[model samples]
Target: MKFSQSIFLPIAAIALTLSSASFADNNQRRIDIDSKVVTEHKAKINNQRFSYTVATGTQPVWDDKGDAIATLQYTYYTRDKVDDRAKRPLLISFNGGPGSASVWMHLAYTGPRVLKIDDEGYPIQPYGVKDNPYSVLDIADIVYVNPVNTGYSRVVEDKDGKLLSKAEQKEQFFGVKADIKYLAEWLNTFVNRNERWRSPKFLIGESYGTTRVSGLAHELQNSQWMYINGVVLVSPTDIGIKRDGPIKAANRLPYFAATAWYHKALNANLQAKDLDELLPEVEQFTINELIPALAKGGFIADDEKRRIIKKMAQYAGLSETFVEQNNLDIPTQFFWKELLRDRGQMVGRLDSRYLGIDKRDAGESPDYWAELTSWLHSFTPAINHYLREELNYKTDIKYNLFGNVHPWDRSGNNTGENLRLAMAQNPYLKVMIQSGYYDGATNYFDAKYTLWQLDPSGKMQDRLSFKGYRSGHMMYLRHADLESSNTDLREFIKAALPKEGQAAKY
Candidate 1:
């Protein structure tokens, strides 16, 4: 899974005390299925009163030969009193971790209720959740799915009641192709079981989930015969050309400038300009001067290299001498540490506005990411409480918020190519890409570069739209960005709707 630098942390083993007797008896193992919980609720969103039904449970995932392999946990919210199911749209959502639960997006902004964090997205003690007035529930019915091994989802025993070993389970759903295959199958099962085949289907994925949706789009259309109407990507990664050489460094320049501007570290003239204006200038410099200079390397004249370094310092908010000493290549980690080193602090790689106090001020990297810790503290407890208390779902299993599913096989994982193919196969498919200005994980500029590469002919440009937020990776954590994102999504969904008498047929 592609993650932001800060999001990937050490995985502590969850204590699951299973008896030796139970482990020894393979035939005694049986499939455990939780009862589905259904509740009716009403909320006033955007000043409009809406009633919806919330269903929380697990759906069985079956293999090709009619054998159950995994059970995926999900929370589905469907608006009540919708006469024609065919007319309403259905959105399937998930977050990335390759092992992350869907709780972040579910409880933060997309679901009917959102966790009550501070305006700046910092956690408040005694974490609580309330009706999210900006939720997308008003526009479409949503299903927040926690992929296998995350949340309450788990691999199950075979039809013969024989449990598969951990290695076997990993072989089934831990790789890029296997993950998409199972998810696509699970989606098919859900839509069929719920009688939502005629409804226009859409997908919303964040971070690595973006990569999942891009690949799933093609997989669904080609393998499962399921055509989707739209896909909404938040903090997308793996869409652009591989981040290496001068391209990688070039893609990061805008983020550096944004980080510098946020900290007021840029030169007086650059700092005086509005972010909208300053970013374009930085982007121009990166493409016209910085990229070319980096490509030429030592072949470039000494004077030109010196001039480029000085200009880079002006935009990146670093000293000319410091930039020169590094040979004009400043990685993101170094920038995070060096940006605020003078004050004995480090900026967060996930969100540059967040400041952290390092144990040692002279280190190349901070000890930990303050922003990630802050979010985990709030989200972890809030999700647990909401699931048990309000949702009425009972589970003794420790929810795997971010499981240890690393060393993931990335072979044949060209999601950008998959997206392009999906678009070509289904010309009516629309896409929306959302990015946060302060997100160092997947830079907004890098996403744009990926889009540029996706549509070289510009024929599908009108169907593709981009929205920017003034927040970080989890942009919706900020209330204002949440509102803005919800509004833009509402518009995008409306625009993506089929024209009069042109509804899609599955």
Candidate 2:
């Protein structure tokens, strides 16, 4: 799980509250809810001027008995004077970190204003924000949603206006199934309230957000009768924990080669080739040699083992002896440290192009990811400024950019299965998976493996497509990749929508 800043409250203080009858009856209590804050704004996309409305606020989630259980916070942007909801698409976007807020996706790429940073996404002194000419607002109405407990979203107070205890809040909204249940309910409420029943709905999620969207597609279909047109997965990580063996190791080979190629750590022949040229050779080697060799385990001959070690060293930028010592399988974490150990530095797991200095270079993992630090530095303040100063939505609660949703229950959930079922149920539902070539966290090849596992028959293969960027997990942090990604997504959205006369298939 991603490390995030959190506030820890003593369990003893809330122990009595947990035992009290008042706490038990709190769910039965009724409370008056407030309306969301809506504001108007103007922006230019593709050098064309357009006016939009920014609605920043929370929507109450009510239970079957009509009591408010939780409130989900969102920043919604809709084009003004667009009367035909059926023609305009609505894209609901979110970030990962089971605990992360939606601010990363909101301010960094999809929203009207984007954070200003260096070309490679490093933080610049005197941080600034700029208008995003590639904003999706030109084609789709965007709603950036923060799951309950992230951003300004929280559980509704009791009739007497008393907030629930931390334990109670966790019980309500912190697990896999629980999260899907509540988010599906919240989306249903938002659609009914906004009268977006006819809009071509799409979901865009990054990292764990991809996991959420996968399950959400199924849940929304069954529970809310909501069928989506498309889903955009950014740096997806839906491979289940049970499937982590030789296949996982094999899947990571291309990523290791890509990272080594980026830092010029590969052999002279590999170094001379571009990343595009080097990765295909590594991927072929992985399937034809590495997976079979690793699957053989101790039974392989010594010469064969030596040959595998040499090839691994060639692709992974490690010594033959080091690769042999690790049983010819170099885990990604070890590669992070080993690849640049001679230079007294460690490469980042999120983005291998990012280098960081460790206190001691002998450790298995780097001290921290430099890219994550750069992201937090730029996104945190930018979101706070946008919410309060620009949109004028004031709140005393500290925005949970990254909250404490640890011990996250990851049980009995497979979004790939959900994705498959959704596509089978709704034939027109298309999927677009985007990945960063330099990202070590969720390798592009691994994402391909996951998608391959989903569709073995090639029947729905045409419905799925992929695009790779020369970036890390958050590819949009870089300018060139951001522009390319916007264009790619725009084309995908246009293709996924129904034709003018034909009704939405969903």
Point out the worst 10-residue segment of candidate 2 by lDDT.
1-10
lDDT of 1 by residue, 168-199 (tens): 77777887788888899889888987899989
Q: Model 2 scores what on Cα lDDT?
A: 0.80
Give model 2's TM-score versus the native structure: 0.91
- Cα lDDT for residue 351, model 2? 88
Each candidate's TM vs. the true structure?
A: 0.92, 0.91
Q: Which stretches in model 1 have alpha-carbon errors above 4 Å? A: 1-31, 159-161, 503-506
Query: What are the lDDT scores of the predictions, listed in order?
Result: 0.81, 0.80
Q: lDDT per residue, candidate 2, 1-506, as tens digits?
A: 11112222222322222113224444453211333566677788867687878777767776666666666778899988887877799999988899999988788777788887887788776765778888788899999998876888767665555676777666667877778888898899899878899899999999999888988888898889999999999999863533477887778878988888888998798899988888889989998998998898899998998888889889988898888888877788888998989999898888888898999978888888877886788888888887876776666678999877776878878777878888889876899989999899988888877777777678888889999999889888888988888888888999998776765444
Candidate 2 collision pairs? none
Candidate 2 RMSD to the real structure = 6.9
Best by lDDT: 1
